[model samples]
Target: MVDTKLKFGVHIRRAADKAAKMTTALSRLMANTRGPRASRRRVLMSVVHSILLYGVEVWADSLSIAYHRKRLAAVQRRCALRVACAYRTVSHEAVMVVAGAIPIHLLAKERKEVYQKKGQPGTRATKKEESREETLGRWQEEWDAAQKGQWTKRLIPRLGPWLGRSQGEVDFFLTQLLTGHGAFRAYLHKMGRARSPMCLHCGDAQDDACHTFFVCERWAGWRRAVEDELGRLQPETLVLKMIESDRNWKRVATFARAVLSEKRMELASQGPASHEGTSSSEED
Candidate 1:
């Protein structure tokens, strides 16, 4: 209806249109069939977000142009929901937090700052003389302000070098741990594919990934064998952080994945159930 407004709208529409198409085509990819929640997120980031953010900084100036800015913001909000696999009812801020995305308007604002800096004369020369300590301080300040509550102080860098070189199963295991998705029956049940969160083998307690892998009586033998392979017992505290850390994550992955695989086979054979009276003493 608004002709002039429609002209600049094409930029965001192009990205949104591409994203909508990708979402439609890859709807099945959302089935959690991939390695772990981490794997799906990587796909979302590496593929979906890559396409969505292409040339998005150009929309920076649109912020001054109200109509174009609102449209641009709307597109990004929708994309964030899809990327996070959150319900449409979720707040855009919540969606962005989970997706590890910044608000598009803010992103544009940040890009505009960089653009202005690039255009300025002698800015780089001035910054070149700044101390490394000053640079780190500035970086820490920005990282501290990245998100609101939990990840506000969190610095999201790449996974460690060993993870880049890990095998497929290890990669999947790490994905599960990092994304906190794939292995958590509570999560899958919440998503509706699983019937219950309780361990089919142990039966008394909830079957969260941590419980099954480390604390479950059912998997003690497997855990011992895994520890033998790793030449050490993996600690329960800071266990998930092991994925990001260089502390024998490969061994953790191999062991956790073996347990996960066995659990899957067990689930498939026994069918998903929560039996209060039946408690198997050992790993399936």
Candidate 2:
């Protein structure tokens, strides 16, 4: 599917369209409010991504163009959002991280590298693993340097350990904590949907992710319960602690769900008048 200019734009667009349809067909399984997130991620990678990247090695170099990269990325972003149970407004980088999925461009490059090494002495599995490690390393470096999603970065400073977790699940509430794009007051103010960024429960400080999770006196009892079992909760070491064991992960997740659920209910009870100046546009 090459153009007169010998560009792979047609192929890329066709692949993206097919993948988008496949994603929609499988929407029930990958819907944010239903099904196991891990299973949804598997379906996305095996079905949607396979269709999108079919024979990617042949046209991998075309991904160097930003337009081509974004075309494919948009498809992957939709699937990742569902896998992470994240809001649509979440940044691509942050949602991909929370979803434990690699970037589409990097994956295409990895496949290309693996295909190039097919004739080498090593087995294909080993070559693919090597390419995956290289791609993940590159992604980690980019994540560290990214300026957007600072809230997510604070929680998950390293992507490797978070991706390797065998337990715990990424549901909507947990995604809210990780991405800081949920029903938080500060986030609402940024979107022009709230009059003040002050905490709805405490009314003393701006209700951002960090303040809600670690500093808010309103949730002091909940935090104390979690800290009693998980030792101490620090933003820098939170992910590490969560991934340490299934008990630790569930404990933290439960705390987030309890607190954030109440917060959501509180905000809803305030009625539409509380959000009088709601904006149609939202920033990443």
Candidate 3:
């Protein structure tokens, strides 16, 4: 063991001597350079000096001392992060290889793409902006002004008893009206993608709200029942009359909701079957 230690010490001493000679040579080269070349030479000399320093420390079997010196220098340079030491059972190089495998930039890019796709708008329409009280007031004011102007006249019963509803319930009913329009608009928006305004269910060329509600064969029978019940009112006016009628509005609303829900369920169930039949026909 003593002989082995002596042999290792001699090799380390020789390696340290070689590193010292290399540093001396770099210093001489920097001294020999002049003018513009001197800056480049100085940078090269510094790098060579650092390499020699690391080499000498390694050869002296004092890599820990060199690492601590480097960390202290980083602190002085304002680039050091707080670090705690642990007795790592694994090799340093192995730890470094594992750390390098982490795709941090890729993860960051993915997060950015997701944010771009679904990030909320900076400014959005708020509940206060479109609140029920505000909307009802605006509509009532317009209706009153119109009645005075003879421009548009709302049915009298609609304005009288309906105005007695609390702000929340009125807002809910207004929301339901807007939801119906939105559903219609959403269908048009999708059909527009194919450059056609055809109803998806009936394939009718004119797939506006009235057509879907009143003309589409898929819902014509249901529409007749609702219209007949509402006294053969125009399709556009049926909803208003139903809502305004003396009958229990809550029960009527529930019935309307049930019909809409069942129709949606029927469509959803039939969709897959239709799609499967189309695909099978194509294969044949």
| Every model's TM-score | 0.54, 0.92, 0.31
Q: What is the lDDT of residue 38 in candidate 1?
A: 41
Give the runs in model 2 whose Cα sits over 4 Å from its true position. 1-7, 62-67, 273-281
- Comparing 1 and 3 by lDDT, which wins? 1
Per-residue CA lDDT of model 2 for 168-193, tens digit only, reads 77897888899988778788877867
Q: Which ten residues in a row have the lowest lDDT in candidate 2?
A: 273-282
In every candidate, how many clashes are there? Answer: 0, 0, 0
lDDT of 3 by residue, 124-180 (tens): 234323333444454445345442312112222134343443311211112222123
Backbone clash total, candidate 3: 0
Q: Give the 10-residue window scoring lowest on summed lDDT in candidate 1.
A: 275-284
**In candidate 1, what are the lDDT values of residues 71-128, reduced to their tens digit?**
5555565555445544343344444444555555555455445555676666665634
Judge candidate 1 against the unseen true structure and give its global Cα lDDT, from 0 to 1: 0.50
Ranking by lDDT: 2, 1, 3
Question: Which ranges of candidate 1 are over 4 A from the true structure?
Answer: 1-6, 22-51, 61-109, 121-170, 183-185, 191-195, 225-247, 272-284
**lDDT against the true structure, each candidate:** 0.50, 0.81, 0.34
Better of 1 and 2 by lDDT: 2
